[model samples]
Target: MQITIVSGKGGTGKTSLAVSLAMTLENVQLLDADVDEPNCSLFLDLDTKLVAEAKIPIPEINYDLCTLCGACSSNCEYNALMKVPDQILVFEKMCHGCGLCSKICPENAITEVPRTIGYLYEGENKEFLFNFGSLIVGEELSTPVISQLKQLISKDKPIIVIDSPPGSSCPMVETVIDSDYVILVSEPTPFGLSDMKMVVKTLRILEKKFGVVINKDGVGNEELELFCQKEEIPVLLKIPFDLEIAKNYSKGVPFLNVLPEMDSKLKKMIVDIGEALE
Candidate 1:
């Protein structure tokens, strides 16, 4: 099953839930798609092999091919190509790498060339497969790399845990695409509950079944319970606000192993989510 863990915003214990869940399932493939800050590997402690380095295709134009008749520029949806009186400029940033400009070019002047966007790593820890995709720091568009990473996943696994980047934006949506179920992780604060609503909307939009797991459950007031009660969304499992667990997390340790109840909860949570998906 492809179970993606996402949050409405960052700092909501998305990775913590993901890593803990990964440890519980044997022969699971764990994907850390938070390209900006990939902390999931901090806990996995696996040996990695370079899988693939992601790149986007940008159209390079040959000027001497004669006419700048504006056909290429006009066909570009992203406006990456603009035709001046005698010249055409390629704006790489705006390019979506669709190759439409190259396809529509009458003069055969346009050719697609790869430009680096990110890197994908594949590794293993015992029976579990660990893979992650990382985008370049200045990359404004991460959906391309994220999509590429999603395609590289091993579909034969009994279980898969994808650590998606926070929020309901393009990157997060792409990460959760084709998922069997989504585990929405959040805290119990107002910000957490508010953000949870946004992701819940995203789930409904995608028509994906999901459950919310309240991280740092006992730290905040009981408004989350009220919200869940009203919405009828199941509370999967609550990871409490414990200092030792925080310190262990801060120092790079798996909480589920230390707190045995969490492992059992996560296992049961997975079973419960599977039933919901079914």
Candidate 2:
């Protein structure tokens, strides 16, 4: 079973829940798909090695035999290419590497060159297999990095858990689309509830099976519970707010070690997901 844990926004205990679930389960493969800000490895103690480098093609213009006909610029959906009177400007960071600019160049002046966007690392121990991507600073695109990391996964594993990026954008969608079940982690505050709606909408649009895991459960959690009940969405599990867990997080420790009571609940959540899949 492939399971992805995501949140409506950042700092809502998404990684905490994912790490807890991964540590509680046996022989699971974990992928931290948040290339922009990957912190899952901080809590995991494993012998890690750089497995691969992720790259994307960016346009390289040859000005020798070229005329700035503006065809490439017009064809670019992302506005990555801009044609001035004497020069064509290429914004490497804005480029999606679609190769459309090169194909549409009438003078064949555009060529593609590989640019490194991120590095893929793999780590493992007796319990779980771990892999994550670390995107280069100031790189605007991350889908390619996430794609490369997904390609490196061994699909034969019994359970695969993904720690997805926050929000309902392309990166988050890419991470969750392949999962058999997605656990949307949320806090009890108003901000969490609002963003959760957006994520839930995205999941429905993608036709994905998902449930809610209320993290940092507290006084305002009833609002989230009411919303879930109204939508008829299953409330899978709740990780309560504890100062010790927060302290452990700050010290780069997995909270599962201290909160041993959550182990069975997390295991039961996995079983529930399996049963729902059936």
Candidate 3:
């Protein structure tokens, strides 16, 4: 089973909760799909070694062999290619590696070239199998990296925990897609409620089974709980705001490592997820 842990916005303890939950499970595979900013490896004591490099195909124009045709530019849905009078300008960052530009090039001037965008790392300890991706800085696209990370891992594990990126954007959707269940983490603030609503809407549209985990539970906003109740969504867990937990997390320690009592609660949450699937 693949359970993707995601949030509507950032700084809602999504990664922290995901790492802690993975720690509670036995012989699981933990995938940090937040390639733009993956931090799960920091909390793990295992040695992460770079296993593979994630590359995307970018268009390379052969100026000498071609005419500046507008066909390639018109075919690119992302507008990554611009046809000037003299040449075709390529925006590497905007390219989605669709190969449409090459296919539509009348002059046969466009060729697909591989560009390394990220690195995939893996670490295995007795507890669980760890995998994650680190996107190159200034890379606007993380969906490709997330896809490569998921594709590289074998789905033979009994349980797989995916730490997804924040928001209901393409990268997050890519990470959460094809999962057995999704766990949306949020806080008890107005911003949290708003973002969580958007994420909930996304999950509903995707028709995926999902639940909510309210982090920083002591905060004085009842709106989140009310919304969940009204929507009939299960509140799987409530993690109270703790200063020690914050301190440990800042130092790259899992909250469950400092507060071992939460282990049973996390295990129960997993059981609840299993029951929900049933």
Candidate 4:
């Protein structure tokens, strides 16, 4: 089963829960889909060997072969191409690789060229396969790179743990789609509750199964619990507000390493999720 651990916003212990669950599960594959800023590997401490580099093949126009007919520029929905009086300019960042400009180019000047967008890495930790992705900085769109990461999931006996992007936007939607279950992590704050509500609405519309995890549980987040009860969403687990956990995380350490108790709790959570699925 592919399980995604996501949060409505950043700094809410989303990656913490994901890494803890990854360390607890036996023979599982971890895929961190927050390509824009993947911090999961920082906590793993394993020397990462390259899995694959993700790239988007964008359309490039050969200026010499172009007649400045403005056809390619007009056909480009992404506005990557612009026609000048004597030449055509192609902005690499604005291109989406749709190939429509190439197909519409009467001068046959457009062709595909590959540029490195991000990379995928895999390494072993204890027994689990730790995998994650890194998006090239300044790359605006992440869905393509995320799709490439999803393709890496093994078909045989694989329990995939996905660390999804924050918020209920396009990137988060793509990351969590078609998952067997989703684990939502949040803190005990008004902001946390509000974002969680947005995420819950999105999940309900998509008709996916998910539960809530209250991180920093003792800091007055009863509203979240009440909201969950009112909405009939499952409250899976509660993690206390521990400064030690935060400090260890800052030093690139998983809570499971310093606090072995996390392993047991995560294992129990996984077991419960498994039973619910069954």
Q: Write the per-residue lDDT of candidate 2 for residues 1-278, one digit (tens) a residue.
A: 88999889799987888888999988889999999999899999887899999999999999995788889888899998999999999998889999998888888888999999999999989768999998999887888999899987776679999999999999999998888899999998889999999999999999999999988887474889999999999999888888888898999887787788899999999999999999
Q: Which residue pairs show collisions in model 2?
A: none
Worst 10 residues of 2 by lDDT: 214-223
Model 4 whole-model lDDT (C-alpha atoms): 0.85
Q: lDDT (CA) for every model shown?
A: 0.87, 0.90, 0.91, 0.85
User: Between candidates 1 and 2, which one is better according to TM-score?
Assistant: 2
lDDT of 3 by residue, 66-147 (tens): 7876888888899998988998889999998999888877878888999999999999998589999999999888999999
Q: Which ten-residue region of model 3 has the weakest summed lDDT?
A: 151-160
Q: With candidate 4 superimposed using the best TM-score fit, by how many Å does residue 79's alpha carbon deviate from the native?
A: 1.9
Off by over 4 Å in 3: none
List pairs with backbone clashes in candidate 1.
none
Please state the error at residue 238 of candidate 3 in Å. Answer: 0.8
Candidate 1 per-residue lDDT over residues 93-147, each given as its tens digit = 8898999888888889888999988998899867889888888888767888888
Order of quality (lDDT): 3, 2, 1, 4
After aligning candidate 2 to the native by TM-score, how far in Å is the CA of 181 from where it should be? 0.9
Candidate 2: stretches off by over 4 Å:
none
- Model 3 lDDT, residue 94, Cα: 90
